[model samples]
Target chain A: MSTFSKTRPPLLETTRPTADQTVLRVTDLTTGFRRGATTTEVVRGVSFDLRAGRTLVLLGESGCGKSVTARSLMRLTPERAVIGGSVQLGDEELLTLPLADVVRRRGKRIALVPQDPAGALSPLRKIGSQVSEVLRVHGIVGTRQERTGRTLELLDRVGIPDPQRVAGSYAHELSGGMRQRVAIAIAVACDPEVLIADEPTTALDVTVQAQILELFQDLQARLGMATLLVTHDVGVAERMADEIAVMYAGRIVESGLAETVLSAPRHPYTAALLRALPVPGVRRGELQPIPGQPSAPSERPAGCPFRTRCDFQHDACSEYEPPLFVTDVATHAACDLMRPSQQAVG
Target chain B: MAAPEFLLEGRGLTVTYGNGVRAVSDVDLTVRHGEIVGLVGESGCGKSSLANTVLRMVKPQSGTLSFNGKDLLAMHGDELKAVRRSLQVVPQDPSTSLNPRLTIAQSVEFNLKVHGWGRRERRARVMEMLDRVGIPASYSTRYPHQLSGGQLQRVAIARALVTDPSLVVCDEAVSALDKSVQAQILNLLAQLQRDLDVAFLFVSHDLTVVEHVSDRVLVMYLGRIVEEGPATEILTAPRHPYTQALLASIPTRGQQRAAIHGEPPSPVNPPSGCGFRTRCPYAVDACAGYDNTPHAVGPDHAARCVRLDDLALTAPQAWRNS
Candidate 1:
């Protein structure tokens, strides 16, 4: 039996919190793209909740549908992409909302911190005005002068020195850490309830990366805003996440509190990912590489998506795709290894 | 016992760009025979310049670089050409390092042919290098685009080793790959070092990766060596303030991280005394005019900081008095 099954039934309360307390909620969300006559699924039945004052890390390698899931929450997926299922913000269903309404709520209710800070900010515009544009558009500030004043304050809050000078400088004038802090300033300008940071530190140096992460942690604690951190590095997840979701082939193979999932991962895919990481103390030449690349969205398998690379794959793994079965309401894994001996208890 | 013989020793090395921009300064480093020495610093710190100078890729304005008994800067023509073959460089991007049109085998064999090896001998040496790097002979026909990033890097490494160079400089050679691929390449490099006995001059900004691959570590700043010592001792208990900060700033796997507050100072006009004084949290008035010279802090532990004498004081007090 899984660890959660030993706990009492009342502790297994699966009643998800209401919308305001729960910053973002997704259910049976499926997203895909159509090529001529065929539809290729990129993200299938992905569900998770980002509540206020907690970090929900989407951990996966490239093409594991982590980004797709994040983009879907904002309805930022392209027109050619087909999206289904319900995404709720508090009580309102976002998936059914009009495009115009979605755009209105984009920066006001939720803000996105994209992967590349250097590419995200316009090169021609001064750093201060770019931040002011968001406040001006949302009518958050009355006058242009007031917007500039607020921009300086936000810059200082994100750890930039000489905010007035930084405000006048262009994107190229700033370093990588300074640029990322500017991006965070832009995201947190409107004081949104949810912030989605996608691989924000992937391109930075190690020292700068640690500073950026520490900044995020400090901001999260101060603002008490829910955060969705998307990264492929297990180390990044370990440092930032309160809860973790391990995605494989466009599905969450495991999800639980970060400490539990990280220290005691149950799924084979989760175990493989943890083993693949090159930790500092570990010897250099003794890497345990997970053989074979993750299957692409266009060429996924018929049964279990990870069967081809899974070390413990059985015949049943190919014959049937296991449903996401919960050992308790808090933790779940979609694998035959976790399949109970008896028919799943209702 | 006498000191282990260093295959390459660089003392008082200095490189200055035009307009009074010093790219490197009185840097001292050594890579011993059958050992790997890692030189780590962030972008613009001149680690790459140091490695390139060893290969004579960039001529230094001053300093002495000696491989065995010969001074590198003093060599020219045939002597320089012979030295270039003895030291090979594996650049950051393998795709750009290798000629896209050439096949894997032809790429490795080119160096042998340039050194005046006969056609038959070149082919045999190319095959041997290919096998050593774990690439099959059949892959000899494949172009750069056909191979994965990992495979491309292997081909780059094999090509560098084809001439049987005694010293190899890998500048972020495996930084571009995924974690698993990075592990595999590191393991391969370590195995190759053991089997081939070729000394490595490794340069990267990632401390964890550097610590894993290096026997000795050298921490560089703007354009100078701030600290140098055995890898484990330096990484575990760094004597220099900059080195300590660098190690403290790294976010290890599954460990909580402490904040690194400020950015590195611009290198164009580095501060007087020590180049790292501006960012060294333990800076004082004396640090502004202190002599910039390497001093012994412990056995093999050396740093170019003024506060090395007062280790018993509180952090803030040390900073005030440094």
Candidate 2:
């Protein structure tokens, strides 16, 4: 009998947060874009700690400021976006760093794999030149010969077939999966301490997405680097993250261990989201949809940003914003109903 | 159960594009009167091309397609137009489907207008469909840009059903919406299917979504139907190796995951014999030959695999919990 989908050993293992060294710490990050004379805040007071070899996933749907928060960490948002936050990378304050200093540290210290590999890559340059450019900028290799050899090595490591042929071809010539592999090769050329991938697998097909996600997992296991992944896919978060921060309306409504947050989400928004997704073996009529569209930053109310669609509504929710209340061990939820004082009543 | 009456039947459908890409090859499918038939496949597998064939949007190079026992390929002019009225489509993106210049009411009314409904009757029917889909009458005046994705999808559904079509083809209808919002649209489609008793050709790349909504499912791989059976049996105990691999590759809430390497091969130069032979882990020497025989595993379940009888594959524990 074929044992293809049987309960054999897992093909890819989910790495626990084994390393204790805190690599990157972000505190109260707020990002806003200039609209006329006023600034429209997109990311509001987002904070997280990324330990070495751990994956911290910023999870949210569209317009939830998850992407904006990821961009704010690297100062990669558009020119008009005003970022106010303290990003600490191994005793270095990245938010206050000079432009040139940040540029020097981009590939050498932290790397980003964007959502769209096509947009991230240069259409005119060959794939080899792009990988070599990263290595050269970071001063990884001295000679041109070493750079070419290392370029091909990086491509091959990322699971690209026929590195020689792929290196000579332009970005537009490869498939979406191949372009993404080239993008991964470029991002990891310098072996950065911290990696930030924003929706990296959202653009590819399911089979290719599995391969790319496995590449990320394998690289993180081998190199022992910290990853800050931002995505809207629950399946990716379930498979990849050590810790997950559920973002809603520019703030983290829930943060906890990935297993806890996904299986027993405390926040109303978090629970609602899990209920909405279609799962195999789920009995019909169990899909309870969240009532309304996610509110835009401009339309968000003063109190709980998620109260409009939340199933459990309290009168105090309209008066003040809820703080992050500890709901369980290693889990926090920003819900008034989950407060310690109201535990018995609730 | 007694034999079900077929609403649409397609046999030996094959489509070769201008660039000689074999998109849909020798696929046979059927949809009952009010049943939801889900067509599942990944990108480059020609699921969309096969969907287009069923939609009558493309004339296959060699095939016979009939709807309501009427030969679809032989129709011309007024006959095709009359048949076209019954074959409605809901595309992947609602933002692109609805006209930005037209109001929501007019967008839905356009279908009725094309069917030659009177002015007064068109307005009344448009309002009726809008309310049935749970869109407020106040929203009918707003333009497409003003509505949300879920609302716009409801409008698209309303537009499709306003013609009282026999079959509605929804191609990736909920793939664009956020997961939370995607639920609302799926529930809406199921509700409409029950209320209207209309046959729906639900095409999506996600098996999780299809598992609950579909009465029967057709698993396509590399321009062929690898498995066709009841949704429960196909999703839980798929006999085809390709279907098993497809299910395993999806990272789920379960603890297990099987990494299937490589993307789908290019359709322009498909491999010989079994289209999935290149990726099948259990591929045998016999898989290299074209026997083109479907082995039946159950009363109404079948898979086109040479090693179907030798496979005891079950879906992941998460998929078999219930």
Candidate 3:
């Protein structure tokens, strides 16, 4: 065990770089789907900044608009959907880019590591060719020889043991973990400035999931690319995120550094979510699951969306939606309980 | 002294699929009355096959399965159907398992009606079971689509328990749910187990969940039981390398653990001797030649490792502290 641990490269850098450079900035991004007269807003004014060479994890349960927010950044919404807000990647505003320009910039400057590795790859194509397709489309390499050489290099970089043999095999022939490694290889093939991974490891076993996460950390350090990861698992967020943003009912309720938000959550929903997880040591029946389900976009409450299920709800919490209150230098929470007057009332 | 009563028992259980792939090898498992036995393993490790075999959903190639001292494998026709009333299963996905067209009440009373119960008794028992699972009696009139995932799972639990089975098999029952909803369903299962004294064969890939709910835990690897002991002991002081690696793989709050390398070997062509030798960091030269057998490490604690006596294995710090 000691030999393996010593021989293996360090999974992640102990000290995060203090560069503090913002790579992707999203401001008041709202996405809504229109059907006839009713327009249901799925992502309501979500905002965050992703630092270069760091990860910002959007944590939420299903239907909380975390996935929609990620998709909106890439302009991947449906034709009928209405998108409002500015997504600035470096100096370019992605939302205002033309269709041809966005398509060019997609694989060239930004890439997506999607969930469902099994379905993400084309079943008809071999793994090596699929990875090479990215290189060809992005014009990362000029010659076919260069593409093949780069594909093997990328596969090897993602920690595939037998890259030569694996590249010849189809997606179905590889295991789930190996297929995910192939997907990551393709996503990083172009060395995109920003990588958006949506539940990349959710389908894998625990052991394989850890490996994929470690691979992401190593690649982020080596490539210095910003990563925006969206996952429903708190443990995944705890392990991967430099910054954490808690989303509920189509809005971010808390945003801050991972250690701050996880250790001392300000919002009731965030605290409840942490408490609800069945961590090892917590006895059975001691877990306090939040009482109610998240409200649907169409049935969102008038004030705070989480007021229906919050344990620390007050009369003022139902009167108006609270804007994010800056709790510390870098932490903020959108909850009435953050106010001194509310604390006094209690 | 007389042995403690076991609600479900299996000896030398072996199951092989049509492709000549042995999904489950000769294994022995027992569940006492009102106890929860958790089966944990990676996907394709044969945990599901063992669960399905015990439920009698799949016929075993060889085994002795007895539920309540009656031979389960020998029963057929009406006798099998009669015995099925005492064995129930709660599947992973509630939405797919339930008939979308049927109302919640109808789905809950399905087994009761199938067993030739009177309409009044079925209705009464459905209402009672629904209330027991924390669902309001009125929601029974609504279809499954009208309820949330957590509510639908409660309905599934209600349907399973309505027949009052002595043993229930939960195959990844809460894996589909959100964290909050998963906790609710787990708590509901624990509460129901205490209130009804029903034995549960809880099968899941999530180790933390299995630890919380199970009295005894069984770890499977490549169609064999690698470890079995009390949940606390197996989780905290794992004897097998596979179990230690699994316990360490979990991404906890503050601990850093080396991820286990390589995927599990294929069940179609598993390695000789120790099934876990391919990925285990502690595999030795002797591991390739030793036959698979459980070595007793302590009281009620056993592991399928040849070097169990020599190795000093401890779980990760997070698990030990937890």
Q: TM-scores for all candidates?
A: 0.88, 0.95, 0.95
Better of 1 and 2 by lDDT: 2
Per model, the share of native interface contacts recovered reads 0.51, 0.68, 0.66
Model 3 residue runs over 4 Å out of place are A1-19, A328-330, A340-346, B1-4, B254-257, B319-322
The alpha-carbon deviation from the true structure for residue A33 of candidate 3, after best TM-score superposition, in angstroms, is: 1.1
Model 1 Cα lDDT, one tens digit per residue, A229-324: 999887788778889998888889899988778777778788877776655544566566677667678777778998998898888888878877
Q: How would you encode candidate 2's per-residue C-alpha lDDT over A1-346 as one tens digit per residue?
A: 2223323222123333347588999999999999999898988888899988889999999999999998787888899999997899888999999978988989767999999999999999999999999877766676677779889988998999899999999998899999999998888887778899999999888877878888898888877779999999988888898999999999999999998998888999998888788777664467899998977777888799998898888798999899899995559999998888886576
Count of clashes in candidate 1: 1
Ranking by lDDT: 3, 2, 1
Candidate 2's clash total is 0
**Superposed model 1: Cα runs more than 4 Å off:** A1-20, A33-40, A78-80, A298-302, A325-330, A342-346, B1-4, B252-257, B312-322
- Provide the TM-score of chain B versus the true chain B for each model in turn: 0.92, 0.95, 0.96
Give the better candidate number (1 or 3) by DockQ: 3
Tell me how far the alpha carbon of residue B237 in candidate 2 is from the true structure, in angstroms, after superposition. 0.8
lDDT of 2 at B48: 88
Off by over 4 Å in 2: A1-18, A344-346, B1-4, B253-257, B318-322
Q: Return model 3's CA RMSD, one decimal.
A: 5.5
